[model samples]
Target chain A: MTRPVTSTDVARRAGVSQSAVSRAFSQGASIAPETRRKVLEAAAELNYRPNRIPAIMLSGRSRMVGVVVGGLSNPFYASTLECLATSLRAAGLQILLVHVDDALTLDSALDQLLSYRVDAVVTALAIGSQRAARMLSDLAIPVICFNSRLTGPWISTVVSNNHAAGLTAAQVFESCGVTRPAWLAGPVRNAASRARGHGFIAGVRANSARWPDGVLEMRGDDSYESGYDAIRRLLARGERPDGLFSSNDLMACGAMDALRQHGSLNCPDNVVMMGYDNIPQAGWHAYGLTSFDQQVDCLVDAATQLLDAALGPDGGPVSRTRVVDARLVTRRSTARLI
Target chain B: MTRPVTSTDVARRAGVSQSAVSRAFSQGASIAPETRRKVLEAAAELNYRPNRIPAIMLSGRSRMVGVVVGGLSNPFYASTLECLATSLRAAGLQILLVHVDDALTLDSALDQLLSYRVDAVVTALAIGSQRAARMLSDLAIPVICFNSRLTGPWISTVVSNNHAAGLTAAQVFESCGVTRPAWLAGPVRNAASRARGHGFIAGVRANSARWPDGVLEMRGDDSYESGYDAIRRLLARGERPDGLFSSNDLMACGAMDALRQHGSLNCPDNVVMMGYDNIPQAGWHAYGLTSFDQQVDCLVDAATQLLDAALGPDGGPVSRTRVVDARLVTRRSTARLI
Candidate 1:
């Protein structure tokens, strides 16, 4: 076996002090250009990978970030986690992914996170109740939620304007000359779901007729079937809504299936469906569901910024809300151009 | 601010040597019951966390496992990762998740994994391409792939019995008296896809003209649209198959959508559609796609065992293959009640 190269080996080969070798690798550490070049050459020849010990001793920077995420079953969360992981890697920090199952609460997950003493935690919409946010706050840990608003005095939240996003979807339908609208809502208890439902109602009222008394509101897990069931129940009620708005794309996809099953749901026809969080599946030719493209890049940027701020010199600002904008992505599902 | 506790404080409070305090925390380290109790009491009072320093010193045994997963878009991989993360956590190991994007080759991801020097590397199914298996042979790092099979001396792979799984699906169809069967296959490049296809064909032949002229095969990415397109194309062909077998639940779902679109596919009379990979969507009432369960628990166990073998005292056997059995799950998509 080849001998493992050490700092001493590099110093002896470079004919410089060990401190000079260390300075060449350390960020912002000053060393003469010639000396740095010599150290680099020696280190390269011996294949010396710098042990993380010096970095730990000098600055206590492990350069490793912890990302705790749940609900991988949902494509929206899965995509967000992918983007977040990629962004963190590009920033030269390794991601320690903690996938908490449905049975495990956010508190128990945080216990594991605390054990690692992660530099920061990016909780991408953890499962269960809102109480987890308070637990995260009490830990005095920096947490940045994705699309989940944290109403506390110490944590930062990164989210899209769900209410405005929903309103925008409805307005698009209204501009397209649709008055009767149905909401294929997620669990109505969820904050984002309620906000969007409220906004959609507001948008519809501003246009015409206040959607009458037959504004079908469906509730289920944010799934395609829930959307489908919502539409089915509405159709059974003998109220053919001209416009359908789903809070998320999964439900919208389900609604699309329901439309297909009912037959002849097309442009200027039976009904038009739109959804939020323009998930990747929305682009498929099968669905091509019109939806809102939540500003994923901006959401991720906000999360990264929050993590950075928590590690900043001023002891970090807490209890801040960052909202990224969303735009309507028209598709065949809603029969909206562009 | 509260003063941070150190080992010296624990030793002073416990009235024992610093080494005794260290032994109290270290697993299998010799320490008397009385002294250990005293050290624990002192640690609790001082709020001192142990093993962080020595764990740093032995960073070589950091117990952090790196997982390079491809296809976050697929829910199966997501579930597998969720299980692996939970299992690893339970076993006192940290997970370093590296999401390898579509464009990045497995070799590049493996290189990145090498840089981290993880105790082990776990790759999801998509990563066991021929080129990647060859790279694994040379890397000398502990690698275990889930639901992926790569034939090589140094590599370890855990896969469900695709051939038998396919045969089981066919037999189930045969029992339902379905003669004309069509196969909605996944991409030709994927090993699991091909294996399942081969097994189904074998079963058809074994049944002796139960499915005469073999099952029609359509190839595309393992997605809903692909399944839809495959079935649509198959329907347009000369022989309209009475039964459809989608290689995955997503594609089966698409096939179901397409079948329903044509308004000819019914449970007993027209067609019976079955899919592989019992993804969560398959269970929903909308699709209820009949599919084969991958026996994820068994798959995870094989993966965990392989990882242990690869990193254990013996440094793994020269060559090993672990194949987990699978079961067929009957559902509404193939509502034939076989």
Candidate 2:
């Protein structure tokens, strides 16, 4: 293997000091124009690119944010990552991405992020364990949980107003005269699903006296297959839901398909469907799914703002929660029956 | 802000030398068990973390692979990223992700990756310009174009045999006895889409004299809306195609919705549709679209194997291309009619 050209080699070739070679590559660093030209010429000839690792060590800043994400199959998460990446990049920061598959991997992913000494962390996954949370807090690294919340001195949260969105779904159901409404919840451990479900059930109980029976709740893994199977099992039991609220758009699409395949049921005619996270597929002519737009751009903006504040010169260990409002986008799936 | 604890602080607290503190933190470093235990205790007390930046500089290996991706709205790309991340993580490597939105941003993203001194780069986007290709080659960085191909001395490619997949689509159309067929291609610069379109056109010309009328061609941005608009325009021109081959499954779904919404045509019965990248949604009961499975796992395996070989000892600037076979997953969308 050939040895990589270093700044020292460029210094020798340019007839300048090593510091001069470094200054030529360092942005905003002072260097004479003639010396800078000489250094660049030598660098181009030797193919010597200035390395950032040692500079990062010296400055105590990597200018890299650790972004931990998973569930790419869920378009919502994928979209969230895209927004976060763009927002971070615009701020002149790079993303050191850690893709965690599950809870077990989340711990190790956090460890890897810590080893890299990321300036900050923005995670789509929830930091579930207190041990992990405490570890991050001890290091004084600012963490901003995107679309998820955790309580810690060093952790901040930016999430959608999921509870209010659920209430909006219930209001839509009531206005449509939908009785026996069902709530399709994500995993039992998912906090966002739980909050949405709680608000929906509460609204259902408070609104209609015709609703003596509580809403039917089915748990899914926030996957299309899970949603499809959940509805299939419900139908097999001869139970029909007049209205359905899903935790995400993907699951709602699956439920809609399952209902259509049942042959007797039709959307917005026999049943109304509402979903969270207004993903792109929801707008397809085939689905026209009514969903809550989590306003990913707003969420990303809030997260980045928090990141900036925490990473700024006056940055300190502070914890705060920012909730962005989610608006409901009505489509054919949730059209009024009356 | 409080100053971060350094190795000197830990060494002082542990009654050991600073080098001993580093050795204790380093894996496989020669250190006494008692000394290591003392260093750990002091480190815990001081909330100190051994920074990896300096170690990376000393070893000249970042253990990070730069992964450039875009089009997360497409499930195919999302799935590909998940597979790559999982495979790379298993090999104990981290990913420095660069999310490029377009060609202009792609150059800057590569520069960022270069400044990080990434060990290898795997890009989903085509490295189009000769200058960019030459830059990577000059740096002796092993560049692997995932699901894309580029010709350079240092560039390796791991992609599905898209042309063969196109031929398979043509065969399906022929067997279905389709008289009029159309090819929906992606962006003009996309090589994969061009290859598929070429193979499909070639196969159509070679196989059936009944196809002398030739296949209609439409261009899209590999988006759902693009496919929908392309079909709408074709229909507006009073051009009716009995068969359709889409560059991606998302566009296929869009085209399917458009046909159904037109109120005159349907899938398989009216128009047998074929798509590439059998994403999760392809199996949904709603679409049940027939598409080619790129076998993401196989592609990821090949890419990682090439990466391993390139980053291994005795590694050279070798160029090669490994093509994974893509198989057709038949569904109701392309069912044969007697």
Candidate 3:
């Protein structure tokens, strides 16, 4: 049998450099149309299908973005991941997904992604330690944290303006004549949750003179069960807040259920509820929850724009943060009671 | 500046072949521990870090699996992807995720995955056409359809026993002393939905002799709004289903909300509801929906098993289907009234 054709043979046949042949097959590679056409013609004639792995090795660009994700059960993260995948694919990149159970396994997840030599990484989970961030910077790998906060050289963050969202929630509650308010915060270590909580307290303090202290805060692990139990336990103690804001929609839904089941309270009539992340379930007829729309498409657009800049010809990995405004979607859950 | 050390340099220093050095760095490669240790020591002394892309080029194994996903807004699909990612990662395989907007974009998604030369593919969407299946077969790629049914050469499918779940739903409804039963089917092209509908109809006919005709059927595109509207439209026509089974849990929750909000009917009181894919939302206090658990972990285990066989020694591309049994989880939605 005759030897199989190679990129070298194609280059000789097409009267172009072997690198030109490789570029002709690589997506998003810079090659003149005429040269690409000639190279393709030669490849077709010679029945040579260039393998991508070898081309990636030659160019040092795998054209793949590592995406590390956790907590997909949360609709917010799931939807964010879905949008990110679509946006990245449109940019001529594929997602190398690494799913971690929690923050504990994140280091290993990063190690695995690094082993694959992905062009860059976009994660929905926080890059936990300074050591991991330094390692990524050392490798000159650009990372974009989607909806998560991370600060370091060569790192970019695209997130919803959580602080603004919290301020808006507080203003809405005050406008509804809510004297007593409560805040259901997410996990303690979550930076976004902390920012939102701070903003909410600041807004409450700025608006009210009677409240020297901040709103009642309940901590949850960002699960539906946690949200339900938090409210249930608070209500059991005979302390009821007329207005409540949850850091996440899933928790807000759980809180609503708890109020109705345990406290015999109905939303809008009894307790006005506001939540972050306007997931699809927030609009269901059962729970018309008023939520902050993170504008997932806009977040994705900003992320891709940052990625493009970082991977561009004059691209030097730089630290940047793009904060998209969160808009409020009004529904029955937060209707003005007063 | 010092020249970068290569695998060849490591091989020379370790007194081993270059291929052995490559294998030593490659995850899950066949290399003796002693040889790997020697290679690692030599590489460390030389400050050599093996780039995975070049190793993949030499080994022809990218150690990556392509996962095509769609409709992540649906909780079931989102959770399924999470499980698949975790399982694949545990097996020392990375996931290359391709997100498609719908069936129309599936072809392009597959093309992108093919360019990456993924070791295998696991899709949540159907492999729509025979041409696409043929293309994958020609490439000698092993594809496992997770919770999807596709029959072709070199294809493996791991799906829940939909028909059995349907039959069980029918029996549950019958035992609840329901005279009027209704089946809400998912999209028309969905094989799992069709099988479940068939089995439900068969069960209805087998159990009830009085009814010559099968139960009433409603079609939905497997969206929450679609389920709500289908039930609302039927209710407008004064057709009330005492017993209802939705092909998916999201739609069931929608149907339940419709029954309560529009028809002023309560589940297990005015109507009993059953759903498939025991999503986390099903157990929410608001719904408490009885559903068939597809056993996501088992399905993932089976898919990975099939993948191992296809990629193992003496492994050849073959067509195989593994149907995991779907178990019914009882809740208030289907609680017996009699």
Candidate 4:
């Protein structure tokens, strides 16, 4: 019924320049507190709210970020997403979420995200292609790769020390005096998965009696069924792995089931299971799965803060990698030692 | 270095109206296939991309939907979100996701979403206030409520037959011929949870000689620990429940663990467990939880399609509800029969 009031109207009423009015509404903008108060008072009286688009347009920024996440089936990712989404929203940025159901669909999701002039791109999926990183970097888009190894200087990354986690799994199993050991890995080329598996092998070589020959390697599709099947196949052999290390909590859950139904073996009595990513279920009285905690919330928060800096004080984009420590949570399922 | 080509430029080259070009790129838009093919060829030859915002502005629509979801802590929500997001995208729309952590913060999230004039609002959270629904409807905003009852004629809803799911749980337990049966319910006021509990009670009253008192009732925080503690409390009583029905899979898993460690009771032999919402974990060998399947993908597809029709030729917003059937998934944990 009436013309909508603008920053100009507020500026005139407050006896301040339009730029001052803009500064008053913009967070971290430079303006005198008294002038800001005056502008806000006038704007409120006139029932005027600043349009969100103009400020972003003036700054040549979208104030939006694209987040590509996969593995929603995993509780760890699902939990981490809550924190990540909240942290970004708190920073005054909106998240355009893209879900990648599978590896092939992941690239397409990334491409769809790239079509937008997003301030930054974050991915829970691993980035294996150096070319992809370079292309995003060329577009002046800051890319944050989560739970993946940094391959080149073009992309930034944050990950738990999967390599060390692997070693911990192996040592925990060895301390339990397991005669046979196996490591179940997800997807052959995932940097994080590979790191965890290699770390376990390295640890086994350092402490176990059977260096290379005794260590068994199992590949999984990162599903509970994969862990279930891997164990079923492992038992078909003359010797069964007394200790098994699963790359993630989901697979570890499967391995635990396999021990119960297939082998009719009891956990921590005849066998022990260790998993990475101490998801909420790890503490559930049902499983009490001993696993490594990735400190996902902390990592995601740090990544969000870094993206903020990259957009502002840090200048365009800088490539760096940060690895956080993974803590071992000792629970009943992995409580056995000798 | 050159200015980005616009839809207008492509429109001119293709000898078509700009509106036609816009509709050609828009999915589900009424445009000729021949015109769409010509537009694509012209756009490709000129290396043009329609600016993401201009078309939306021209149509006076954001082509974006605001999704309000709570209980991301539940695997069911995360699993459903992927399908919902994809379905929306395929229909030429974008999603703005808001996570409702608590009721107090829900209003603020809604306020922010409303500021954008989103084409519609879809929520998985319960809308308790009639005034809130009326306000949105007055603004010509179509509200799609998931897993909630239709409170008013202004709101549309999609939900599983929670009542049927409850009855299924009770029948399965009765067939197992348990001396004592118990039902675990979520928040006392949640309509879906209440529907499930009442249905279970009704079924027990019909089938079992125990009638009302013998069918024990338990309430939980809908967490694994809550289920764990619920079972512990039930066992502390002189007569432990021989059959347990958890409102959700998470709590059931906890109940199962409590049976093994806390009571030294065996599954399917000493006690039988049935859960609702057969999440991915229910099928895992460790739990083998017999649960009700909500058919999330089908439900999500139906919701998306409803939103489409509401926005298109379907005319004015209609307050209606659709209920999808919940099928019983039989598993090892609930295999024992009388």
How does model 1 score on DockQ?
Answer: 0.34
- Report the interface RMSD that candidate 2 achieves against the true structure, in angstroms: 1.6
* Cα shift from native, residue B33, model 2 (Å): 11
CAPRI band for model 2: medium
Chain B TM-score for the candidates in order: 0.86, 0.87, 0.87, 0.87
Q: What are the per-residue Cα lDDT tens digits for candidate 2 across B1-338?
A: 57878899999999999999999876668999999999989988988888777678778888888888888888888888898998998887888999987621145465666666788887666776677777778768788876555557668888789898888888889889899989999987788888899989988988758798888999998888989999999999999999999998989999999998998988878899989999988898989999999898998899898889888885678988999999889999988554
For candidate 1, the lDDT comes to 0.73
Give the CA lDDT, 0 to 100, for residue B35 in model 1.
Answer: 98
Local lDDT at B295 for model 3: 88
The positional error of residue A183 in candidate 1, measured at the CA in angstroms, is 4.1
DockQ, model 3, C-alpha based:
0.57
Candidate that beats the other on DockQ, 1 or 2, i.e. the better one = 2
- Output per-candidate TM-scores for chain A, rounded to 2 decimals: 0.85, 0.88, 0.86, 0.86
Write down the RMSD of all candidates, one decimal each. 5.4, 3.4, 3.8, 4.3
Rank ordering of all candidates by DockQ, starting from the highest: 2, 3, 4, 1
- Model 3 steric clash total: 0
The two-chain DockQ for each candidate, comma-separated, is: 0.34, 0.69, 0.57, 0.41
In model 3, how large is the Cα lDDT of residue A106?
50
* lDDT tens digits, residue span B10-105, model 4: 899999999998888665789888999888888767756555664454565677787776567688887887778778878767777676675211
Clashing residue pairs for model 2: none
